[model samples]
Target chain A: MELLGRETRERFGLRSRSQAGILIFSLVSTMMLLSSLYAAEASVFKKAREAAIETASPILKFFAGPIGWIEDRLGAISDYFRVLEQNEALREENAALRQWEEEARSLRGVIAALEELEAYTPPPAAKPINAFVIGEANDAYVHSMIVNAGANEGVSRGFAAVDERGMVGRIVDVSPNAARILLLNDVQSRIPVFVEGSFVEGLLVGRSTSQPTIAITKLANGDKIQPGQRVITSGAGGVLPRGLTVGAVAAVDKKEATVELAADYARSRMVRIINYKFPDVEATPLGAPGAAAAAAEISAAETAPATAADAANLPAAPPAAPAPVDEGD
Target chain B: MSTRADVLMRLAGAATPALLGFLGVILLASPLRLFGGEVPTPVFPLIIVYFWSLYSPGHLPAASVFAMGLTHDLLSGGPIGLWPTVYLVTQQIAISQQAYFLGRDLGVVSIGFAVAALVVSLIVWFVMSLMTATVLPLGGIFWQMLATVACFPLFALAFGRLHRRVVIEV
Candidate 1:
């Protein structure tokens, strides 16, 4: 290796020390790039990446502190300039919302009655963990952001992240106290979604733009996707929960449909990471041991006109019961 | 001055460019939305690397550039080594063309950076597309390159001042 290096340096007439440094570093960098591509899926590489982010999280948060303060001050100044107009808009919105609230109340009652008649069981409630956006990767090719919540805060990979308006993205990497969210507009992000009120199912694929297009996976005969139709998670892959509002279809062409994301990526400061666990099939099965006992207990509790506080005090049912068959049998 | 003090000053001078490069990475990764809309992030580390390579390649060095790019990749959650390779190759190019950029006015230097930024953006777009096995959009890359080129003069001015005041002074 030393002889080859000397011969190459002599042949190229590269006598400068800096030239040697460049050559050596370029070779090293090429090797590193190739190795990284080869080991992209290796666990060690993932761990190292997580560790680097974990170490840098504190430094990033420290740098973001002043930026946050500046943003707040700027927001306040902007708000002051538009307060009157905003107040009038808010008042109009409030009046309309009151009527919608009443309608929603009646709809809730109807849904409850329908659910009782159908013996329907709702999906498990999601636990939300709040996080602050500390960093963002608005680079040429990648669109992602770092949040100040991670495994320690009940955040896990694949957990859905949402702002007030709608879905933001999902957790892709998580350290102890930090996580990276692959935003909806990143080139690598893909989510299964279906247009609301239609049988048009498709994959929401990002193209490094604000509007991600839909790649149709399933479309029933004679069903057309139109503009302004809401797009939502299909839960087909079991990674994300079903029925989360993703976005609304903004434009539809013969071969492509784009969605206008609901979450305001540019101005979103806080997000809620939803920690949801898909329920196990066996855990909710009928005819298991203790099933009749649990049903009787539930019936007894239902027979009583319990107050809300009493409902809170009720004992929770076991998730699953063991089989009662003897070993000999 | 004491020998120890002189040594510390020399070390500080040597470390200044790399430190600024790291700072560039941190600032780029930080969510400092000074603008209200989706503004493209100017490639700060690229500017830093190019400036230092043109002026004093010994101070910033190729290794430090590699580290900065790796840190950026880690923070951005992109493919590791993707940026390090880009940065190292860019640095080499900058060093090779140092003679032309040296003693040039800000406008000329910035024009040079414009060309470099265009090339780097295309390289990144091509490599990323190849890695992902799909043709990535070019709009973001174009905006980013434009922003980087537009911001180059300001960064070059700052780094030039820092170079004169501290790097050469020490």
Candidate 2:
């Protein structure tokens, strides 16, 4: 009878201990959820703050006038003593750059005019907004920052951020008046890129540390991809544009390679939004290059295709005339 | 009336954390910057945490420690929870260690402070790497901890006066 009583008591104690374990687990999860929720709530706080700032714009502007003066005075004095010579050098360098730019622009015009003359058009356009850097973080683990511009400024989530140098990162979260930029050195960041020399495609992953690591999954076991090669967005994925210079292969770390970014994250003070819309090539006539030839053949031979079908479903164009079939041949 | 001194004493107790917290952040930011080779070590926040936990737990509640950690997170640009977790854990550890450190000499106190700082820093780095799934360099973190440890004596001496004034000798 005593043994039976003691057994019941022991069982009761065991149940109580399990209950405590469950309670602790529930508490930890609740706290984690609360932390994430707090981050989401921060966006609302920023929106409210932005509204308050806007309402007091005039008063703030008055105060900013003196701050602006100090900035200008400091800039002027610094320029007078240290920057004048540098500015002169920059102007001379700028002159050369402008000449080169003009030459490149004209060459581009020649190619584009010819393509247009042949009735070439491009993918749809996207809306873009210029944004200034309010702050930058170049930490060892996470390189990111908050920009003053936000959803109120027409910035959207997942938009690719970049400067003249190259890609910056994508918009992770945004408030009405402020947005956070996840830099290329962030661990959660990744982008698809195509190797210029080999046309081999893979992903560029960030490590949060200064030297972000690149992990290419498509290459063969003994593939020989060289260093110093250029990498650009493949645009095979619908997110990023094709031919945007992402970076160059910096080093081939045994199994993978690292890319040295073109944009100096440390030096960049501003960035531009690449305005591009994913083109549904299948909807466009360019889906099959020879579609035109086959298209012309069918149109010339008959008023309509024999089968009534979607115009976009037309068969591929006939192969371009054989090399020997040229006019002189 | 039991008015003037009572209100003054209460006010001083309430404001200690905020005052100390602000000064601490300013001191801490420089040291973190120096670790990155851009600025110096910040000793104030760690010092404040130590002082409050050891002498004035009522004024520097754990919630306030967490908030201060969050603020430091914003200023230092670290992962938001990193410093707050460190602050929370350090506050707890500091409280628990007060008994061991109760009558220790200056040298022992300094060593104790250094160990506590190292533990807090390690906690920050460990949890950070776990969440981010990336390795952070520990070399700079160590140097920063050493600097904070070295400054403990000076901070304790300064805070000791205020502590004595606020809490009557028991």
Best by TM-score: 1
Candidate 2 per-residue lDDT over residues A1-329, each given as its tens digit: 99999997996775455334334433443364346334633654344434532332333234334533454565566567767788889999899999999999999998899787754555566666676555444344545655557777887676788888788887765667656677777766788888888757788888654555567767755566678888887776687777778888888876678888877664455677655667555764757646865787668558444433434455543333344467566
TM-score of chain B of each: 0.95, 0.82
Interface C-alpha root-mean-square deviation, candidates in order: 1.7, 8.6
Candidate 1 local distance difference test against the native: 0.84
- Stretches off by above 4 angstroms in model 2 are A1-106, A123-127, A135-140, A220-223, A280-329, B1-13, B19-47, B70-82, B99-113, B132-170
- Alpha-carbon deviation at A110 in model 2, angstroms: 3.4
Q: Which candidate is the best by DockQ?
A: 1
User: Cα deviation in Å at residue A230, candidate 1?
Assistant: 0.8
Each candidate: RMSD to true structure? 7.5, 12.0
Candidate with top lDDT is 1
- Cα lDDT of model 2 by residue, B37-80, tens digit: 23224446777877777665666766567667655555444444
Ten-residue stretch with the least lDDT total in model 2 chain A = A52-61
